[model samples]
Target: MHHSLFLMGAPGGGGNSSVLLIYLGLMFVVFYFFMIRPQSQKAKKQKAFMSNLQKGDKVVTIAGIHGTIYKINDDNATMQLEVSPGSYLKIEKSALSMEWTMAQQKAAEPTK
Candidate 1:
């Protein structure tokens, strides 16, 4: 009976159980907005960029090989990259780094 009375009196000291629950809920909301949402958006944008890749696009591989897309074997999920005139390398389409390639392209552009 004493233990039961102590447990009942614990809620009277201004600490509410729902306060912890609300804090946990608020943390999830913050995590989803700051972490999950941006990561998902970046993935969607990367997928779109990869799908729209075509011949003659200059790209940088995740391994940092800079080259032009000479051919796209969509059925086989591979591409032929021409690192130099008449030289080529067949690789997976997923090996391309969207962020790195875009940065390289931006650097290559001449200022107006």
Candidate 2:
């Protein structure tokens, strides 16, 4: 009877389980901070850049095509881009990426 009682009264193996749960929770927090937050921030910045596009702004498309904006049809979700003199292409607004902020800065620099 005392042997059975001793076995029943022994502490259950819950300490390891609780430690595992704590470890998993910490891993999730680390992943969110390192992997998820920066990506969301980049997406938000890209969305803002796309929304602020205007006519006559130079932009580079996602396919690496560079052009100047000839027209903006925000209602129709399209824009006309002049890739070269006397050459033009109609592309969706989403196709444009990475506005030429650095290019503009370079142009504004005084030539040596």
Candidate 3:
């Protein structure tokens, strides 16, 4: 007589399922903001930097070669990296490092 069966109409049974779904949704939102959103924004910035490559701008390649942009062959997606005066190495625009270039620029600025 002490034993009872939990039926489909149990008071708390349905409540937990909705709570679990809400918790999962909240976790996805958190990950989207913290991880996915920043990654996408960074990719956009990198793409813009790649597209805006110009002659006479200094850049460092991802492979650690630093040089001034001698010529941009947008027709072929490559650039001539002049590591020294009249000396050049042709490489892809994608090989440039945006973060390194920004750091070098920051270091070159005079502090008041």
Candidate 4:
């Protein structure tokens, strides 16, 4: 009985519970700021990019296929990509890689 009491902490002091609550709150805040916020912001950007897509916009897919947006099917969330002259492929909007597409666009730009 005495050993259990020692393990459980002081019966009269409530400081430990308060401190634990504070620590958990701090951890939640840290996780939100460092992980959740950035991810949601990135998702918003990706959604906006996908929504703003139009025909003739060149893009790179997550699968590394480079093509131009030939047609957008809003109802099914798919698009037809022109991979080459007279060559086309159907793909999902979500398959587009924002990072690779940005990089490809940057490479296509003329450097000053």
The weakest ten consecutive residues by lDDT in model 2 span 5-14
Error of 1 at 35 (Å): 1.2
Q: lDDT by residue for model 2 over 1-112, one digit each (tens)?
A: 8755443443685465666677799999999999999889988987887778888888878788888889887575898999998799999888866545446536768999
| Candidates in order: C-alpha RMSD to true structure | 5.3, 7.7, 5.4, 4.1
Candidate 3, 11-106: lDDT as tens digits:
657855666677799999999999999999999999998878799988998988889999988575898889999899989888889999988778
lDDT of 1 by residue, 28-112 (tens): 9999999999999999999899889999999999999999999998674899999999999999998999999999989999999
- Cα lDDT computed for each candidate against the true fold: 0.89, 0.78, 0.85, 0.90
Give the CA lDDT, 0 to 100, for residue 1 in model 2. 88
- Give me the displacement of residue 88 in model 4, in angstroms: 0.3
Output the worst ten-in-a-row residue range by lDDT, candidate 3. Answer: 1-10
Q: Backbone collision count in every prediction?
A: 0, 0, 0, 0
As for candidate 4, its clashing pairs are none
Candidate 1 Cα lDDT to native: 0.89
Instruction: Show where candidate 3 strays beyond 4 Å.
Output: 1-12
TM per prediction: 0.85, 0.74, 0.84, 0.85
The 10-residue segment with the lowest total lDDT in model 1: 6-15
Residue pairs in steric clash, candidate 1?
none
